[model samples]
Target chain A: MTPPSRFDEPWQAQLFALTVAMSEAGHFTWARWAEAFGATLKAMGTDRLLDGGADYYAAWLTTLEGLLDRSGHAPVDEAAATKAAWERAYLATPHGQPVQLPG
Target chain B: MRRPFGRCILDSGFGAPHDAPMPHDHPDHPHSLLPSDPALRVKALETILVRKGLVDPAAMDEILDTYERKVGPHLGAKVVARAWSDPAFRDRLLADATAAIAELGISGRQGEHVVAVENTPDTHNMVVCTLCSCYPWPLLGIPPAWYKSDAYRARAVREPRKVLAEFGVSLPDGQKVRVWDSTAEVRYLVVPMRPEGSEGLDEAALSDLVSRDSMIGTGLAGASK
Candidate 1:
């Protein structure tokens, strides 16, 4: 019962949760999300980018995106577009406040 | 990216068979962490994952709530606290860490190969994955962003004392600093020394003093020196 909130930000917590949620809900059936993630990373042609290896959530997001798209749910680039919109919202939002996507 | 399971393809948590085929065309940026802007990419991925019925928001909320309410260093702290209080379990942990940790029902994937290294006043141990961010996820959960940094991965082994200094951990000249390099097969978790005057503290209270960085050997338990 010591203090929690080990995650530094809301987004990190979100990514972790999403992975667990999706996995638990029986969505990660066909392939190892990790392999799917590797496949996504491989197909994205970012072989040159991962040399430094700093981003974990980035991998998670890519895996999630790949999973959804591979499962025939999301269209390719939909995640990318959403990502851009969120960036705009985040840029516009004031500091110290939750970034909300503008309607 | 941090590895999932000893470089092996993970068992899809549930057993179902649907091709997780990815859509192509978002060409690589070739030099950055995210192929696109960080915030936008994360949000875009999250939104689409939910919208396309690939995952459920409610389950996601539950997972979020679990990490917020249940997971954290407390899990690791508790194990350390228990080991500190119970010598038998400590021995068990040292002898067979995976089984020792599972005794508390606190077991998961990355925990499969985790080895616990205790820090004594004479010997201080720190962990780093020179290859990738192979962390002990069962107890500590996901690693802090810094743990996954290339700077730490490369620097931790070359200059353990300097890294410890940057982390505000100054070991005496005579104190031996052991830097355990994590690999795909094994990861190390440092069990920091129990601070004095904590004898009266219960397991839960003792865990309160254990910080996440302490388990990683970057910080210490917040007990009076």
Candidate 2:
């Protein structure tokens, strides 16, 4: 099906596509992804009920990060540092213009 | 958009009962990968994946940009416009969307089983996937985050009018609303009612006025945006 353009936002679509691309390339198996994601959902636990409207893609990312940690695959602190840089870029970038990571 | 995680999130951090313990070790604030903004967060993830060689940055840009800038509602718009101009094609679409769409040479994932619902003056249709984010990816590309959200999935069914209204799709009280929930196996595509004065326009021209949300029944086609 055409993914619907129904993604609540652009990030959701981007992330969804990213996961598919990574999986297709055999970087991670669907089973591995499901386990990690399922664990993350379980972590949300009883509180998942309280966080009434959590974004799935967000949870998916958390699962990916957590899985990477388990597998020892991330570029030591690269994910953390990239996130920080994005936060900084978002702050620096003006509204309506796309944010770019600076060199 | 943040409905608290009940007691899971303490006044301080995760699993902190009494004093809101903020561990601050890349603490997961929300929105999965944090960074708050979706675009920025996506960028961050993309950067890391590229560095790891799991994803080629150039190809990654192309894949994302294809859906973001290139592919979109326009493709669906053409299908819609052709249906408007040709009743036979519309009938084929309604009867066997896959075959009809295939007639136009459009085929891909997420649209393996497409069910086209036409919007008439008396009735309107909308699409959703309450179970999961099962969208007609081949026709619409990527779905919006709201389409995948828990709130939208619930509200789209329970209070469709309210949901449509929020989407700026206020319908007449007389028109009955039919909501279609897309599944992994079957996908629903809404063929919106064509606007008047669009009569003289060709299929391509008619396609120009079609927006992405219109196919999902959240917006109207041919209306000035």
Best candidate (score: lDDT):
2
Question: First chain TM-score in every candidate?
Answer: 0.58, 0.73
DockQ of each: 0.17, 0.14
> For model 1, what fraction of the real interface contacts is kept?
0.32
lDDT of 2 by residue, A19-44 (tens): 76776577777546655665564555
Top model number, DockQ: 1
Candidate 2 fnat reads 0.21
Worst 10 residues of 1 chain B by lDDT: B2-11
Supply every candidate's count of residue pairs whose N, Cα or C atoms clash at under 3 angstroms: 3, 25
lDDT of 1 by residue, B161-216 (tens): 89888988888899898989876457678899988888988999888888899999
What TM-score would each prediction reach against the true structure? Answer: 0.62, 0.60
The model with the greatest TM-score is 1
Residue B132 C-alpha lDDT in model 1: 50
Superposition error at B62 for model 1 (Å): 2.2
